[model samples]
Target: MSLLKEKILQVASDLFQTRGINSTGVDTIVAVAGTTKMTLYKHFHSKEGLIIEVLNEHYRHFHAWLSERLDRKKPAERLQKLFDFIEEWVSSPDFHGMAFLKASAEFPDASSPIHELSNTHSQQFRRYLAELAADAGIADAEGLALQLSLLIEGAMQAEQIKRGSGAIVYAKKAANILIKSSLR
Candidate 1:
């Protein structure tokens, strides 16, 4: 990405995550990016296009972060690391709610490209969780994955709505119990 495009993407991603997709305006993004509407359109074509790019960026960065945290750990230790990753994530000062979750809510139309991108990211996340569960020798890997995904999502929401409420801590305990019972 060019410097201008990178700046626009960073500003838009931050604004969208902090404010919201629907509430944020192209003008504001351009202003923050220190660019013009023409430049934004030159890069992204339209706001929806920009939104999709932002979602893609989030997906890439998140997967990279997750891979770093989980890839080196032993299979049995992966779940523990997963919980630790999420706890630290939710506590970070830059912590914002899940971008996919926010996008899906803001663009509820099932047929919309924005919604599709968000849903795809979510399904990919669930699949990644199932992979982790399988690696851990869980008896019902898919079931365990679903349980863990929901727990993580709920914990994130709790942190967004009730910061410092120990939601992630509770989530980790519940996750351990679920993992223990699911072990083959």
Candidate 2:
């Protein structure tokens, strides 16, 4: 990405996460990004295109982080690391729920690129969980992975809703138990 494009994505991500996707106009993003409408449109075809790029950037960062943490570890340990990652996210200073979750909630239709990206991210998470479960030799890796994914995703929302008081604590405990039991 060019410097200008990177700057725009960063500004757009911050604005979309804070003010929301629908409400944050392109002009606001360009202004905050220290650019002009011509530059913005030159880099991204439209506001919707910009939104897609923002989501893609976020997902790329998050996926890289998760992959780095869980790479080539024992299945159980990798699973634990995933939980730890979630805890870190919960404790992040700007943890206003998940950006994708918030975006999907704001735009429920599957026709949009935002919704498609959200579903793609969800699929990636499921695949990661399934791989870990299989490496652990779980009887039904697919099923277990789905359950574990749901638990982690649910706990994230729960933490955000409850303001992260004890949500991570409960989620970690529940996740560990689920992983252990699934391996048995």
Candidate 3:
């Protein structure tokens, strides 16, 4: 990406994540990006287009971060590492709940591109969890993945709404019990 485009994306992503997709306008993005509407349109056809790009960028960043943390760990260890990462993530000052969830909330129509993109991001995460479960020799890998994914999503919402880190800690404990039972 060009410098201008990169700046636009950065500013837009930050604003969208902090403020909201519907709440943040093109003018504000351009102003923050230090660019013009023309430049933004040149890079992204419209605000929806820019939002799709932002969602993709967010997924890329998240996948990279997750891969780095879980790559070297054993399959069994990866499950625990995931919760550890989530704890750190929810506890961070920059944490502002799941961007994908926010986008889904803003665009509730399943046919909407923004909503689909958000769903895609979520499904990808669930698939990753499934892969990890399979690698760990779990018999019902997909089932376990679904369960874990629910726990993760719930914990994220709880942390954001409750403004505390206890959700993740409880989630981790629940996950441990689930894993142990599944292994036997």
Candidate 4:
């Protein structure tokens, strides 16, 4: 990416997360990004196009962070590491709930590209979990993946409401039970 494009994305991403996607305008992005509207248009074409790139870029960073938290140890340990990292993430001060969930809430149109990208990001994560479960010799890796996905989502929501108090404890315990049962 060009220097100008990267700057625009960074500014827009911070503004979007802090304010909101729908609330943040192209003009504001350009102002914070220290670029002209023409430059942004030349690179992203439109606000929607910029939003798509911002989301796609967020996914790349999120995936890299999640990957770093996992190891190639026993399959169950790999998942447990993921669960622990999630708890850490939720507890972090920077976490403002799931970014995709926030984006989806802002763009409720199911047919929209933003919504589709949000869902795709989630499905990809679930598939990654399923891969872990399958490697652990679980009989129904898909089922386990869904179960874990729900737990993670629920925990995020709970953290939003409860401000990160005790949600992870229950989530971690439930994950252990779910993973244990799947191995049997």
What lDDT does each candidate get? Answer: 0.89, 0.81, 0.89, 0.85
Clashing residue pairs, candidate 3?
Answer: none
Candidate 2 Cα outliers beyond 4 Å, as residue runs: none
lDDT by residue (tens digit), candidate 1, 1-184:
7999999999999999899999999999999989899999999978999999999998888888888888889987797689999888778888888888889989999999999998999999999999888887787889999999999999888887767888999999999998888873
Candidate 2 has its poorest 10 consecutive residues by lDDT at: 72-81
Clashing pairs in 2: none
lDDT for 71 (candidate 2): 85
Residue-wise C-alpha lDDT for candidate 2, range 137-162, written one tens digit per residue: 77888898898878877877786677
When sorted by TM-score, best at the front, the candidate numbers are 1, 3, 2, 4
Per-residue C-alpha lDDT of model 4 across residues 37-124, encoded as one tens digit per residue: 9999999878999999998888788778877767546665787677788887778876767778788888889999999988998899
- Estimate TM-scores for all models: 0.96, 0.92, 0.95, 0.91
In terms of TM-score, the best-performing candidate is 1
Off by over 4 Å in 1: none
lDDT of 3 by residue, 1-184 (tens): 7999999999999999788888999999999989899999999988999999988998898788878889989876787688898788778887778888888999999999999998999999999999989888889989999999999999988887878758999999999999889999
By lDDT, who's the top model here? 1
